[model samples]
Target: MNIGIVVFPGSNCDRDCAYVASDVIGQSAQFIWHQETSLGEMDAIILPGGFSYGDYLRTGAIAHLSPIMDAVKAFAKQGGLVLGICNGFQILLESGLLPGAMLRNRGLSFRCEEVYVRVENAETPFTNQCHPGQVLKIPIAHAEGNYYTDPVTLSSLQANAQVIFRYCDADGQSTGPSNPNGSLDHIAGIRNAAGNVLGMMPHPERCAERALNNTDGFLVFQSMVASLKTQARLTAR
Candidate 1:
């Protein structure tokens, strides 16, 4: 699996995602700068987490119009898999690839911690390796992670099964305290209508190693690789 890790001006997790791709997933990750016009035959793309454009003009606003986004959109329109973590998630929302918007944390502070995430829709490519209700530990680090959308949008999201992950307690259960950002409906992640693109606040790349005391995130990436592999095989047959 050749992965392309997108690196915007302030992307802090690009190397981290690449580290996991090369070391754990055993695939070389090519870093694609934000100004690049093409994805260059990549199997998948990851928009790593960080305060893009230093969070100026609101999170992900300036970065949304980056030159590479057009190519990124083209890729996703073709059913290519895209995973946006943290600031990447914000970019997705800004780009209208995913529904909803992020707001300043209800507490108004940067938060970093390991939290449990319940897999709500494993039927999608991102989390297809896990079963519904399975709990995974993923780290979330962000200052503006509170997710919000209007009633109509939220309803449509629910109707489409786009809500994929929710915050959970240490026992793998949902609670107000466990959901640090107080996102409506405890949502931690969501997918595009087509289910090929996913944007989640949690950093799965950070949780890819057991020695890091978390490996739950790896399955989701592995799941995508597996799903794409199966689809390719089916098409070839």
Candidate 2:
């Protein structure tokens, strides 16, 4: 599959994502600069984690108006797959492609460590390889990753199974201070109602290899590719 990794001015993890996508995920991945107007032909697009525009205005506020976002929006409207990691998630929220918003961590500090998140729903394209209630060891490095939403939206999310991952303890229990960011209901990740777009605060690309000693993040990427393959097969039939 051909993947496009969006790179903004302050994007630091673009190379890391491309490395994993090419060497580990075995996909043809390329960087799409922020100023670029075209996404070319790509099966999937990823907005890697980083401080876009140096986070001058807000986490993703400045980058949301980037020229490429219009193309990304159009891409998503066509039912193309899109994944946003870390600050990219913020961009998705800002661009109105995903629901909810982010706030500063409840600890009022930057959290840069590994945390556990349980797969609340594995039916989506991003988590088809992960079993329901399975805990994944993923790294999160951000200060404003706290996710929040209203009561009605939260209710809809739960009813539709849009909540993909939630912070939890090592044993997969969603209790205690395991929720590093104070995300509402420990929500760490979510997908659009259509299930084609996903936005998450965790950095899955950072631990998709053996050197990371935790390859749990690979399941998310592998699942997306596998899902696309399945869709192609079904379409062919």
Candidate 3:
């Protein structure tokens, strides 16, 4: 599978994402500058974690207006896979590609640590390699990772199984201490209703290698590659 990792001016993790996709996952990967108007022939798009545009007017507020995001939205409309991590998740929310908004961490501090997120719905393209209720220990680093949405929309997301990952303890229990950013309902990640787009606060690319002593995050990228392979086979048939 070919993956495109978007790079904004302040994007620090684009290369990290590319490394995981290409070296770790054995998939072709390329960097897509934010100003580029075309996505080319990529099968998957990743908005890697970073403080885009210095996170000036709220995280991702300015980056969403870049030329490439329009292409991303269109690609997602066509059922293409899109994954956003950390500040990328902020951009997705700012672009309105995924519902909800990010607020400052409840503690009013930047957090950087390994956190556990339980797979809530593993049937989607982004989480297909994970089983329901599987706990993944991924690292998260951000200040505005707190996720919030209206009550009605939250209920709708829950009803539709759009809630894909939730903050959880090592034992897979959602608890107050387990939520690093105090996101609503312990939401660590979520997919769009179409299930092709996913936005999450964790930095899976950081922990995807066995050398890092944690490979739990590898499943997320593996799942995307698997989904693309499945799509290719179905198309060939």
Q: What lDDT would each prediction earn against the true structure? A: 0.92, 0.94, 0.95
TM-score winner between 1 and 3, please give it: 3
The TM-score measured for candidate 1 stands at 0.97
Tens digits of per-residue lDDT, candidate 3, 1-237, equal 889999999999999999999999999999999999999999999999999999999999999999999999999999999999999999999999999999999999999999999999989998999999999999999999899999999999999999999999999999999999889999999999999999999999999998999998899999999999999999999
In model 2, which regions exceed 4 Å deviation? none
lDDT of 2 by residue, 94-126 (tens): 999998999999999999999999999998889
What C-alpha RMSD separates each model from the true structure?
Answer: 1.0, 0.8, 0.6
* Residue 110 accuracy (lDDT) in model 3: 97
In the range 133-203, model 1's lDDT, one tens digit per residue, is 99988889999989999999999999999999999886778988998988888899999999999999999
Which residue pairs clash within candidate 1?
A: none
Better of 1 and 3 by lDDT: 3
Structure candidate 3, residue pairs in collision: none
Which model is ahead, 1 or 2, in terms of lDDT? Answer: 2
Model 1 residue runs over 4 Å out of place are none
Write down the lDDT that model 1 would get: 0.92
lDDT for model 2: 0.94
Best by TM-score: 3
